[model samples]
Target: MKKVAILQSNYIPWKGYFDMIAAVDEFILYDDMQYTRRDWRNRNQIKTPQGGQWLTVPVKAKGKFDQSIRQTEIDGDEWRDLHWKALSLNYRRARYFSEVVEFIEPLYQNSYRTISELNRAFIEALCVYLEITTKISNSWDYQLIEGKTERLSNLCQQAGATQYISGPSAKDYIDPNIFSDAGIALTWFNYEGYPEYPQLWGDFSHGVSILDLLFNCGKDSPNYMRFVKK
Candidate 1:
């Protein structure tokens, strides 16, 4: 049976996010929704000298219409510089520092100005680095990517998916009958059971970006991901 997972494209999300994608046959990049400021698209956890700090992509809100992920512009580039500088200083003494530096250099150079593009870059790069082979599709390219839950149900059925996975929060509002009527089985991505890797600062970080694990553990991070059992 074909399985699928739908998620708003986020910036280099933590390990469990990728695990959910890897668990299914088709992973949907659900990026057509209204963009909110100060959200996961712009802010994520990263290791720092002090501890796990939130690295955010500053956007010019301009009090405009709820911006599109494709429209949100990267404001001051200072946050990018500061984050890189901090990571450089803190991880310079790390064992896998060289590998981390090489991997992240391209990200700093690109300096993505829009949320959708930035999210795409992060997800695609992570998939490549992690060797994930699941077919990824952007929701905007296909119809049924819209605000209502009915549309989402149709999208799942149209994709020829027998199973659909979503974040745990989805259960609160999305009527189960929608998927049932469409003959799509629904499951929740329980990310509550992920394992901790070799975190840099000797603390448990549950929600940081995946780059943190990659940087500290190098190629061994994949081993930790497997520790998350059903």
Candidate 2:
């Protein structure tokens, strides 16, 4: 059966996000939806010696009302250098920092006008690093319907997915009956059993960016993420 997952693009998302992508046959970047303020779409937590810190991409959200993620634009070109500097300072001592730094540094150097573009670039790059072979697509390619769950269900149907896979957080709002009505099986993904890998700083946190795991564990990073190929 072809399992499909639909999730918004996130900036250097955590291992759990990639795990979900790895578990599905097709991963859809649901960018046609409204862009929420202060969400994972433009920012994400990164582990630091002090604590988990946010590295947010400044976006121009002044006049746009309910702007779709694909239409949202970056505010300025200044965040790139700042973000790269923070990562370099904090993760410079990571075990495999040198190995992964070359590949990751260029991403920050390149210019991106939109948040979705920047996020998709990183997500695709990290998926390759983790050996995840799932086919990735954009939700804008499908004709979305109105309503929350209906839009998701329609996206799955458009992709010809026999099964719809979703994150556990969606259990609150997602109706299983919707998928049943669409003749698609529904499955919930759990990110609870992740084992801590060699992490920097004192306490380990699973909420930080996947770059933490990649820089710290290098080739063995996939071993820590569920569903990722070894």
Candidate 3:
């Protein structure tokens, strides 16, 4: 059976996000949805000596509340150098920092106008690093229907998915009956029970960007993650 998962693209998302992608057969970047300010679409946390620090991509969100994630343009290119600098300074001592930086640094150097493009680029690169072979697609590639559950269900049908895998947080609003009605099974992805890897700073944090795991573990990054096999 083909398993599918749909989620908005996130900027260097945490390990759980990649776990969700690895659990599915086809992962859809649902960027057609409206963009929300101060969300994962443009920012994510990174572990630091002091504490968890947020690396936010400055986006032109003022007065454009109705814009979709795919349409959300970055405010300027200035944030790129600053973000790279932060990663370099914080993770320079990480065991595999140099190795991960070889590929990741270029991503920052490249210019991406929209948040969707930026997030997708990072997500896809991380998936490759973790050896996840899930097919990634854009939400706009399929015909979207109205209603929240209806649209998700329709996307599954269009993608020939027999099962739909979703993050546990979506359980609150996702109606299982909608999938049942469409002859698709709904499965909630579990984010619990993640074993802590060699982390920097004081305490262990599971909410930081996947880059933390990559920097510390490099090729063994899959060992700390759930769905991706080592």
Candidate 4:
């Protein structure tokens, strides 16, 4: 039976995002939603003199804009230079810093900036690099059967999935009985087992963005996800 997971598209998210993708048979980028400001979808952290500052990509705001993951814009291409410089300065001493930094530098400069596009492409690139066999698809292509709960379950059934795993956010309020009503077993993903790297500031810090992992660990990142705890 196939396993499926759905998550909001984010900009170059952490190892956990890839972890979920790597662990599942099918992964979907849920981009059919409101575009939030100052959210993970819009910006992320990078090492800065101000102690891990957030670098935001500029976006045009409008009323209830239901922007797809492919449409967002990267407001400041110049910022990419600042980011690359900062990472180089701070992580030059890291074990695999040079290689990882070299590998991602072109991506930072040449790739498109919309959060959705970046994430979708990043996951695709990383998955191939890591040799993951899981198949991925965009949610916009299917007719999601309606009834938030039934919508997901029915869609999974349509895709030949027997199990559905959701983010921990589902643990608090998602109605499990709804899945039962649709004949799909449900579970949740908890982000744990963050790996330790040469954190410039302290012994360990969580949530510095995936760039932090790459700058410090390089190719070791794919295996680091194996440490995730339940």
TM-score of each: 0.90, 0.97, 0.98, 0.85
When summed lDDT is taken over every stretch of 10 residues in candidate 1, the lowest stretch is: 221-230
Q: What's the best-to-worst order under TM-score? A: 3, 2, 1, 4
Candidate 2 off by > 4 Å: 228-230
lDDT preference between candidates 1 and 4, better one: 1
lDDT of 4 at 133: 69
Q: Model 1, which residues run further than 4 Å from truth?
A: 145-147, 227-230
Worst 10 residues of 2 by lDDT: 221-230
lDDT of 4: 0.71
The clash count for each model shown is 0, 0, 0, 0
What TM-score does candidate 1 reach?
0.90
Model 4, total clashes? 0
Candidate 3 residue-wise lDDT, 43-144, digit = tens: 999989999999999998899989999999998899999999999999999999999999899999999999999999999988888888999999999999
| lDDT score of residue 210 within candidate 1 | 83
Quote the positional error of residue 221 for candidate 1 in Å.
0.9
The lowest-lDDT stretch of 10 consecutive residues in candidate 4 is 221-230
Model-by-model lDDT, in order?
Answer: 0.77, 0.91, 0.93, 0.71
Stronger candidate by TM-score (3 vs 4)? 3
lDDT of 4 by residue, 1-230 (tens): 67898877776677677778877888888776567777888667766445777766566555536765456666656766776676677777777777765556666676565767766776676666556768888777678765676677776877778789898876765678877876778878878765566556654666777777776667776656653322
| Model 4 residue 182 distance off true place after TM-score fit, in angstroms | 2.6
Candidate 3's displacement at residue 218, Å, is 0.7
